[model samples]
Target: MMRYMMSLLAALMLWALPAIAQNSGPLRIEITEGVIEPMPYAVPDFVGESATATEMGRNLSRVIASDLSGTGLFREIPAQAHISRITSFESPVQYADWRAVKAQALITGAVSVDGSGRLVVKFRIYDVFAGQELGNGLQFVGTQDGWRRIAHKVADQVYARITGEGGYFDSRVVYVAESGPKDQRAKRLAIMDYDGANVQYLTDSSSLVLAPRFSPSGDRVLYTSYETGFPRIYVLDVASVGRRVLPTMDGTMSFAPRFAPDGRTVVYSLTQGGNTDLYRMDIGSGASTRLTNAPSIETAPSYSPDGRQIVFESDRSGTPQLYIMAAGGGEARRISFGQGRYGTPVWSPRGDLIAFTKQSKGRFHIGVMRTDGSEERLLTASFLDEGPTWAPNGRVIMFTRETQGAQGQARLYSVDISGRNLKQVQTNGGASDPSWGPLQN
Candidate 1:
């Protein structure tokens, strides 16, 4: 249980001793090279300023702790091992007490609900051995109904402050929520928080849907639907659930749609004359342009962060491999030279790396490589893994995994870019084809 965490004085000193020597300087952890060990921290139940906020504070703190510990970069010192109780928001810190319990970092907060029903949360991060707070305390206010989002926002702040990187907690994911037997599976377009909470179905399981991708702003989704008895591209408003099909060449099948950096443009695969190729479309004008005229299959187009170039999967080389081309489309350069076939290449938000699904030998894997296809690293391997989606911060990936057997099912799983912190994302039932949306404002 506590083995993942370091011993009392050693753990606290490892993180805080340097800041103490600097006389209460800022504290940060570097994650680029990967963290070999988890940092031990403590988040006590937040103090409630109002009668109605007592339980909300407790739940809020728990969610924050879960978010941090889930990264496998931080370990929360259990409340049962807490030596000091934080009963007030402004109380002075007992640094020695926290250090005694092996806590290097301490998070303290307060929650209040106003008469108008607005939820208010304020929090502070402290370096225990330094006996000082890391940064200025911050406050977040929102409607009471959005309390869960508020918790995520607090966790994001804490994560950014401690790790010196952007956080992905305050975001949403759109996926295909599946049910029924494998042969006659029913799939619906569903959206939920990044943590798998507040699930709301956008479309009933009446029509088969596949490969849902979020718009640049996350206000709309582009997906392939078989409602018309053929694969067609449809754009759906996430809030109102209104949808309309994008006009394409008659008798051509369209699928694997993704948005460019500009929300108005879309890139997808269009199959005509039994030849599948990539095309770019302007949703507002209903006009389209052929980007690829190849005789082979080209699909799963993803744009660079600047929208200048596109990375996709094609088999022009006689094998399913990853390629990069200009956003307008031209001769593509092969970037994948590794074993097995690679597909579903998604560029990271930071414009640094691309995540893809690889099928090698008898196993499937979710892996990442540089934009130029160097330094390939496989993060996960299983019976079947495909459709990798990048988190908003580009530090993690969520993908679909299916087990083998007659009763096998597909579920969502996420892994850190460093190949650590592999875990399943809890959903109501079976889920797949996850498209992680941008973090909320």
Candidate 2:
């Protein structure tokens, strides 16, 4: 009887531990589905101590303001129109001056050097219209070189508090960088800060590569390459640049690889004969199992955040559409009923929606829909906008956009889910097939 009672106690503890873990983290607001107008905000130059500190403060504030404004959710008031300059960091803000400039929200801060030589920053977000502090003021301490990260964190906090959605500005993206002409393009894997800073190439552009994806831990990337003269999946260690070709069936093309949420298995498309189907391979032992047996093209498999199901693109219905199947493989059900073809479906990390590239009316668009195919919303329309990759927080999407002209160009761009804040992301050359990495350490 005592053993049975102890067993019951253990079971109860196991269940209760998950609930405790879930409640112990920082609070996050859920952004609802709908359209809302952007809020007007004013972020003036933060007060600083030395000349270098002043310049750093202004640069950080400018970057933060740009980041917020580019989300299409906040409008930054021009500094020239400011009625008053922030002279003192500790003094109370003159609400009348902010109101006079038609600013609805205000952000102010101060930067100084701590005794230990680290940079100290204190910032606050204020609801000018509501005449109240939105949240507690926050402080960050880091080296001077980390000013951009500090600014991003500050912007993230402010964005989260105001919009109720998780912030994604403090993130990075890893993608295939393309250069040279269209016919003989030289492509190399690269990574950069989320805002297109600190670009670094990972590969030497000696082989053809496509569709790079970040592992769940963001420490490595899984992609397809033709290094051996045949399409094969390769895993790359981001830190050491180590490479490993995943072992699979000889002569079979394994492409469109994505790491399972557990980061131990990979789901990809394996082409046999003329048919492409989905399969999962264990990373450690290279043991493989077929997930889809249908003769249709099943590719671009993305695991649901919970790892229970996968959303992929299939042409079984005579036209390409989105479908969901169990991770262990089962009968797949189509979830897209829109007017045109959809491909490259990616499950959002938040598990709320799936983003895809839609080809309709002779034009392509980047759009998102609920997991069950409901509430389809197009976030971008263009001659060609493909490869919708979600930000770490899932509030924003980065995709490739191409324009036709005398000098046609392909560049990276990001947009909010509401079809707002269409801004170009700078790259060294033509960029496509952008995949955003998870938040870094």
Candidate 3:
């Protein structure tokens, strides 16, 4: 009896090990010639069950198409090119019609207005070549006023199923919105949808705000505000927009604040007298722990995903460079040995690479490297490109890019980790210092 029980236990352990390993598998992207070509697909206008649902059906289809096509990983075959039309969502797909147009995938959906006046969307995706549905059909229900959000959900689902990486469509970005002249720039904290829609101002332009960083949970944002006469760290709840300054002593300044993965602590720079050092503080108890006692400047600390290590920028080596150290703080090893200075090193969500801003010669660039600083590759170069924030999947990065000269301006841009698909993030006006929040639940 004992031998039989032991054999059963060993079999169960073997099965569980493979399941755990599958969960951490590499992201799904079929790379070819450095980057994968956009997959060809078709998404016909959805069928509407009610009069009120007609417009939503059309608009939702457009939104989903735009979201997928904009990534440069998927191409949408125009309606005119489609050989067969989808009049009913439940009808079987004519795979041969899609194949005639060289479409590899097809999407069909339906929209309806429930008795409760809520919007309901149902959709399915198919591998046209294989002539079968990729997964079970799904539905999303939400208020009519939230149609756009519901559209985002539909897009997110399609993106996730096609790419193995989680979708970032249902996310937000917090940044400093600038207006007025470059010299008298009016910087204010602002939040907007990941696509740059639904802009909302979080703070007035009365004081300057900079370097907004989102907490791991995406509910709180940490930024350095100059409202109190000197640079001070302030935490604001994204949902409520309520804020309070972090505790600090007189005649000192704190900046470059970042939240730990656990969300209970923060790491930032404290400048006392003329010297700057790195310190960690517990948000709840207000207790402080000094991470670096160096006389040189040490700032811009970012935590690893597991909360075991931190990557930050330091000038201890005489020039600004990237460094990594134990999360509790100790001897730091320099990770950058490039031609110029590097700063604002942010650890990727996958914990396998570090993204940073490098200043080489007269040009500024946004780049990434392995955690050990090998295989460094610059993604973008301009007169001034700095402050890179990674996407939720860590496959893309958003950063601030400023033009040169008297009429210079700052804008937000994104680039894939493979150094392709450089895109300008549309905004109301000039913007900078963007912090990307996680995908919404």
Candidate 4:
């Protein structure tokens, strides 16, 4: 009897945790499915104690402002419009000066370098209209080489304090970098910061690679390669760039690999005997399990945040559509009933929506729908827009967009879930098949 009571109590606590975790403060920004006006904010250059620190401070402030304003949720007021200049970290904010410029929120920061050359960053967020600090000030310590990362951390905290949601600035994206003409393009695996900075190539353009998926912990990547004359799955460590092909049956081919939420297993499409189906693999033992035995092709499996269920694209009903099934794969249910053919479905990290690429009439689109296939909304339409990947916070999506022409090239683009702030992601060369990783620790 005591054990039963304890179990019930624990279940109740788990149900109540999400409500308790939400912020119910005066400075919170409530986000709904409708259009929202961007919040106006200001970020002055941070104060620094020395010459090198000053340079770091200026760049850090610029990057932080860019990170916040790029979201389309917050608008940055130019430094020239500010009436007050922050000269010290210990000084109090001039709320009246900020309010004069109609800045609803203000961010102030400072940078310092220690004797060991470690960079110290400190920041605070203020509710200018309320005339109070939104949250407690925080500090981060890192090396000079990681100044941009430190800037992202500061911006994330400021965003969280004002918006009452998790921030996604401190994250990275793994993608396939492309070059040359459209027909004879060269593809390679590359990783970069979320805003298309700090690009590092994992594999050269000597071989073709596609559909790079980040591990749950962001330490590894799974992708399909055609180096062995046929498509196969390979896992690469993000830190060392070391890679190894996952073993399969002597004649079978595997592709479209995605990691299960547990990170120890992978779900992918396998082809054998002219039949394509989904399969799960235990990476530790290299053992394989057939998840689907249907005659139709099943591919692009993505695990839910809890790992209990999987969402994938299938062609069982004569046309490509979206389906959901148990993680262990027994029975499945169709979730999409729309005018268009859907494929490449990816489950959002928040688990509230599933993003997919759709084809209708004569155009391609990137769209999102609820788990039950309701509230389906198309976010983009392009000549060739596919492979939608959600940001860490699930508020934005990045995908590949290719222009229409013989000389067309593929580039990366991002858009808000509401279909606002559509812009191109700057890369040194053509980029596509972006996989957004989790935020850094």
Candidate 5:
């Protein structure tokens, strides 16, 4: 009996090992150069027994379909074309109807209220062409107020499954909100969900502020303020709105503050004695160390994703160019040699590329390049496109675009890494200096 039990235990361990390996496997995705035609999809109203469950099911399905359609990659078939209504949880799906409507994919779901009064949503995605479920259906439980997040999660899952790259729809953005006019712009630090919901003002428009950057932890923001009548760095806690002025040398102006990847220090540019240099400050002790001392302007210091090096813009070589320096403040090397002046250098979160704003021949552009400054590609060209901010996945870039006229406006725009899918982001008034935040939990 003991020998038999030992053999059974060994067999069980082997089976469990394979299950663990399968769970840890990288997600499979299809890669294509371009889609000549949008993929057709159908999203039917989900079924639920109760009124509240029915409403939530419908709304969640609508939002998820809308989010997918907005990407310009999927064409949502009209409900009129959907031949079968999802009436039962265990009902058989009519794949022929979806195929007849020329839908490559289909989404259906059901929702109900659990004993705890929270919503329980179950959803399934189908491949109409294959006449089978693409992946396992998922179930989620959340409060009514979290319906939007559930919608985003569903969209993200679909997007990742289709595109292989991660989805960025469930993120947030922290930007400098501008009002009044261009010259006397009343700017306040503001943050909002990626879908323009939950607008929270971090600082009152009492002082001039610029370039608010979210910390890696997404709990603090470091920005430059003219509150003390000079451009100085201030860090504000996003949760409690508590503010603290960073310690600096006397008669020095610090601006363009960005948190290190470790979230414990901030690197920014400090102008002392009319010479601008880079400095890193310890947030805990308020100790600062100079990084550069060249008799040139070195601003907009950004850290590489690994937190070992820094990329910044400097005019040390007659024209403004990008340079990389050690995090401990050492010898720096130039990285950009294009026929333009580059500024606002931002290292991509993926650690493979660096995004920056380039000016040349009376026009501005948003561009990215490899860390060694090779394979530079301009993503956007306009009268003025500056301050490039990378999405968390590093596949898209958002920047500020200003028109060229008396009534010119400034707004935020985003484009994929391939320079496709250009869309404008809505703001209260004229907006500029956008900083994309990390993905929220």
Candidate 6:
């Protein structure tokens, strides 16, 4: 009878332990088909360790929340609904308090200013139900003026940990900044953070600039500047704001430049004798190599992520279409055969898709397709949408959407690869040809 009772107690204990674990266990979220609710998260104001850090602590917490919630994968639980307050970053998280508010994730942070006037921000993310930290806590040190960047960095780590994908929050974008009316618009080159925060102009409006492309490292920019009476390619240093024109013949116009993954080689188009052909140039030696000899207008050359192939727009088949060829210049294969004229083919960083601008039936679209010209999908269609740029993750695309009629204004718009979350990027004035840079290291 004693042995039987012991056996029953052991069985009951085993079942009880699993039941307890189930209620306070890590929540694994798998994103899939339709209408899935966002994971609820809570972020209390960061603890300010010193008098100077009071405002910064509050601001940093707000920015971090905004960054994570903006992705649509995580939802912020309103502070009013939070049942518990975090008074110290080093204190043990009260999982029961978070669970009371039905929060799956909790974020805690502390901010302080060191003796050198540099700001230090440290944070940790917790799996509330699991009653454990997600991974490891992180700390960032930077100037007080760059607190926003530190906040973005913390959000990036948390996002990558939960989603199992790289983060794009710590990146920048270079674009054509325009002012005045569309007819006589004055354009210059400008760059800003991915969130449109630190706006800085790289060039003056004394000349027209177009199609600014970032180097693979994001430290340099390549753009077409008509500073010398015609369209010419110029390379600009992001740090120094200094620029120099790429070598070209006196009468030949070179435009549509793109950086290879190697960062030293450039492939662009040169128009001579009314024939536009693709050419590759080495930045150091100014050595030019012709990649395409066809009579077609081959421009907007983009290299594959592996630097093995190139995808560009060409009119070789009588209509503007997309074609892929060896990076070293060889026989080409047409990849676009839909009911539209395609141009501005940008190879995604992941090399899984190529984004392009399509025009058909008096309408324009921003679309993506596989490498072998299969599984074509259009994400957006409007009056004059053009120039599709990919996010670092390749899960989102940004493009230019122009309004219709005489009031046709150009603006930067972004959408997910699934054809959802269409959003307009706010700038000081008109903006176009937005190029996204890689994530900051």
Candidate that scores best on lDDT: 1
lDDT score of residue 16 within candidate 5: 21
Candidate 5 residue runs with Cα over 4 Å from true position = 1-29, 34-36
> Model 6, range 164-248, lDDT digits (tens) per residue?
5677788899999888877988998889887778999999999989999999999999999888889999999999998889999
- Predicted candidate 1 versus true structure: per-residue lDDT over 1-441, tens digit per residue: 122222212311221232211323455563222125777899998899877798889999999999999887788999999989999999899999999998888999999987788999999999776678988999999998898999999999988887767899999999999999999999999999999999999999999999999998999999999999999999999988999999998899999999999999999999998999999999999899999998999999999999999999999999999999999888899999999999999999989889999999999999999898998989899999999999998888999999998899999999888677799999999999999999988
User: In candidate 6, how many Å is residue 35 off?
Assistant: 3.3
**lDDT of all predictions:** 0.89, 0.83, 0.85, 0.88, 0.81, 0.85
Candidate 2 displacement at residue 303 in angstroms: 1.0
| lDDT (tens digit, per residue) of candidate 2 on 54-106 | 98889989989988887765678999999978867888888888888877778
Task: Mark the regions of model 1 whose C-alpha exceeds 4 Å error after superposition.
Answer: 1-25, 31-35
User: Candidate 2 at residue 439, lDDT?
Assistant: 68
TM per candidate: 0.94, 0.88, 0.92, 0.94, 0.89, 0.92
**Candidate 4 structure quality by residue, lDDT tens digits, 1-441:** 112112222211121232221333455554332234667889888999999999889999999999998887777899989899999989988889999998888888889998899999998888787788887889999999999999999988987776666799999999999998888999999999999889999999888999999998999999999999899999999999999999998788899999998999999999999999999999999999999999999999999999999999999999999999999999899999999899999998989899999999989999988898988889899888999999998888999999899988899999877677899999988999999999999
Candidate that beats the other on TM-score, 2 or 6, i.e. the better one? 6
**Candidate 6, position 377, lDDT:** 86
Clashes of 4: 0
Q: List the residue pairs that clash in candidate 2.
A: none
lDDT at 340, model 3: 99
Q: 181-251, model 5: which lDDT tens digit per residue?
A: 66776889999877566678888999999999989978888999999999989999989999999988778
Error of 6 at 387 (Å): 0.7
Looking at model 1, residue 437 earns an lDDT score of 98
Error of 5 at 102 (Å): 2.1
Better of 1 and 5 by TM-score: 1
